[model samples]
Target: MGRTRDRLKKAIAQSRIPSSHGIRYANELLALGAWFREHAEGVPAFARNRDLYAHVNEEVLGDAPIDLFEFGVREGSTISKWMEVNSNPASRFFGFDSFEGLPESWRGGVGETPAGSFATGGAVPRLDDERVHFVAGLFQETLSAFLTQDYRPTGNRRVLHCDADLYSSTLFVLATMHPWLDPGSVIVFDEFDSPLHEFRAFVDYTSSYRRRFRAIARTGPLLARLAVEILE
Candidate 1:
């Protein structure tokens, strides 16, 4: 089996045919499907991402005060849902985004989402909630400073909402935030079905970081929105 896998990899690397690109994507989806079957087969499924968030907030985190960091806040919708579901005054919600959409073109099952697709004309949403905060810039430029100077670790559970639709963005956030990821940290991915992007990041991050997590809940077709609890 190992030899066969190696031969296939070699052939794929050597291939220059245009159709090979599609084959590679299909292979990634196959891998993702296998992973979902293993990790999320019996997990609760919801009709909407908000419902999944509520489940994670109420059932998984027990509606306790949480340090929620959202990586890709476009229009502030999902973060708003999170704040509404977990209405602990003590909970702090921080949103990080370029507010300029994706840094690069994203090619996934739904075709290419061009760079700047989600741009809000560089304006941050106006949320009336003081508990919510927004950091406007690319994650590469802003996150390290925020983590070092502004972020304060507390007794509150940490929830990472990774809506960044690019593999590079998702992996960077996961790796950079590794130090603060405790055993019980909850990571909710907003687009887990994009095998080459978010799902690839999840697989790579866990493998590279030596992290362990269990899928607790999912929503959307093909488990698009997935929430997992870190176990180690």
Candidate 2:
């Protein structure tokens, strides 16, 4: 059996088929679909992301104030939607972004988004809400520092919104925030259906950290936006 497996591996290593983006993406989707069947088969689904957010705020999270951390603040639209959904005065929203767009190119099933795709000229959003705050800089540069010096732990439930549409960014946020992710914490992934990016990062993070989560809700086609609650 071992010799047969080695022979198969050797043959695959020497195969001449050149892989393209479409081919790779198709394989990723197949893998992602299998995973979804196992873990996310019956979760509630929503048509739009905002509706999903509202459901999370009202149904899943209830009226209690939460510490909402948004990892990708492109134009501040989603974070703003979160603020609108959770109106408790005690809830705090922290948005982290370069405000300069994606740190690297994002190759999706559709096409490639060039680096700096969502750049806002390094300007943060102009939201008037006092409870909302923005942290500017790369996640690699800013998240750890913020977690160390500025992060204040509270009894409030924590909601982590991961919209960073790259594997590196998502993985960094997940691994860094692992220490603070108590069981019952809620995590929402904005581009969850991107098999090579968010989905891959999520699988890697959970497996590496030995963490468990249960899907609570999903939105958009092919479960594009997904929410999960940490089980332990």
Best by lDDT: 1
Per-model TM-score, in order, reads 0.91, 0.89
TM-score of 2: 0.89
Worst 10 residues of 1 by lDDT: 1-10
Residue 187 displacement in candidate 1 (angstroms): 0.2
lDDT per residue for candidate 1 within 113-144, as digits (tens), equals: 89989999899999999999999999999999
C-alpha RMSD (angstroms) for model 2: 6.7
Model 2: residues with Cα > 4 Å off, grouped in runs? 1-23
Q: State which candidate has the highest TM-score.
A: 1
Error of 1 at 6 (Å): 27
